[model samples]
Target chain A: MRFRVFVSLKPTVLDPQGQTICRALNGMGHNSITDVRQGKYFDISLAEGVAREQAMREIEQIAQDVLANPVIEEYQVELLEE
Target chain B: MRFRVFVSLKPTVLDPQGQTICRALNGMGHNSITDVRQGKYFDISLAEGVAREQAMREIEQIAQDVLANPVIEEYQVELLEE
Candidate 1:
């Protein structure tokens, strides 16, 4: 099994990195692009035959416990069978 | 319409930042986490009535031309209608 996790700042949260990149883009004359938010991706390979529901639960646990600050972030999980 | 662009390093490409994070995770005793990859997400708010296909095309152009190295990174675009 393989899992892909996407964690991002909640919409209400301020993203400084995204703002900086937006400013940089504007400075470089890329006006068409605007208001960017930044996030992180994680790809994990697990042993075969692990159920998607189980994996999701474990990943979500890992997320809330160690991977992210639940107060200001949200996450999505995708399970791929190998 | 709004566009969300996700740009990530190609699977074959080595991700130093992700590797560093993995090391940090291991050092912090999070041994269950493994094989991490890092990427960026952009949330763009576009004027209404733009077609999804058009938004995708422009985003891909921006990605290949300025936002990412096409040879090393891949991108996904999502159109959200408000």
Candidate 2:
């Protein structure tokens, strides 16, 4: 099975990369773009035989522990049907 | 209105950063993790008054022309209700 995870900075957190991109876009005349926040996306494939519940738990742990900065970022996980 | 965009490399393309993370995870004893692919996520806020359809079209164009490498990556855009 495959799971998709998105890790994003919290709304209160500053995103300099996102700001830089937004500025670049504005410079290019994309005035309609008001704000931009950047994040990370991950596609994870799990080996067979792992129970769904176990996978979810493990994924949550992996997401929090390895993929995202707990103090500044949040993560969402979704199982993808294959 | 807000939109979320995810840009990912096509499966045919190799992802070294993802591989490096996967290797690190495996080294940390997360053996159930089979494969990992990494990508970019963007949260875009569009200024008020742009029609949904126009926003969608402009977002598609921006995604293709600026946010992603069309030759190697694909992107998905979703509108988020505020």
Candidate 3:
């Protein structure tokens, strides 16, 4: 099975990279772009035979403990159908 | 209007960050995780009054020219419904 994880800076956290991208876009004349926030996306392929529920639990734990910085980031996980 | 852009390393490109994360996860006992690929996600909010088609075209251009390095990365853009 495959899983997708999205890890992003918390709304309250300042994202300098995102700001830089926004500025670059504006400089390129893409003025209609008002805001740009950047984050991380992970595509994980799990080995076969793991139960769905267990896999989900493990993924959630991984997202919280390894994939995201709890102090400044947030994460979401979703199972993808092959 | 809002757009979501996903930028990922090309399959042929090596991703050290992702590899490090995978190793870390395995060391942490998530052995079921077979493969991990990392990418970037952008949540962009565009100013109002822009036609959807125009916004999409602008976004595609931005994704290709600014959001991603075409030499090593590929990007996908999608409109988000609020």
**Individual DockQ of the candidates?**
0.46, 0.89, 0.91
Recovered fraction of real interface contacts per model: 0.53, 0.90, 0.93
Please provide, for model 2 over A1-82, each residue's C-alpha lDDT reduced to its tens digit, 9 standing for 90 to 100.
8999999999899999999989988898889999999999899998999999999988899999999999999999999854
Model 3, A1-82: lDDT tens per residue?
Answer: 8999999999999999999989988998999989999999899889999999999999999998888999999999988854
How many clashing pairs does model 1 include?
A: 0
Give candidate 3's TM-score: 0.95
Task: Order the numbered candidates by lDDT, best leading.
Answer: 2, 3, 1
A4-59, model 1: which lDDT tens digit per residue? Answer: 77888998999998888778767776565667777876776555566667767777
DockQ, structure candidate 3: 0.91
Candidate 3 or 1, higher DockQ: 3
* Stretches > 4 Å off in candidate 1: A23-34, B20-34
**Could you tell which candidate, 1 or 2, scores higher by TM-score?**
2
Chain A TM-score of candidate 1 vs. true chain A: 0.88
Runs in model 2 lying further than 4 Å from the true structure: none
Query: Which of the numbered candidates is closest to the native, going by highest DockQ?
Result: 3
Residues forming the 10-long window of minimal summed lDDT in candidate 1 chain B: B43-52
Q: Candidate 1 residues B33-70, lDDT tens each? A: 56677787777654456566776776667667766779
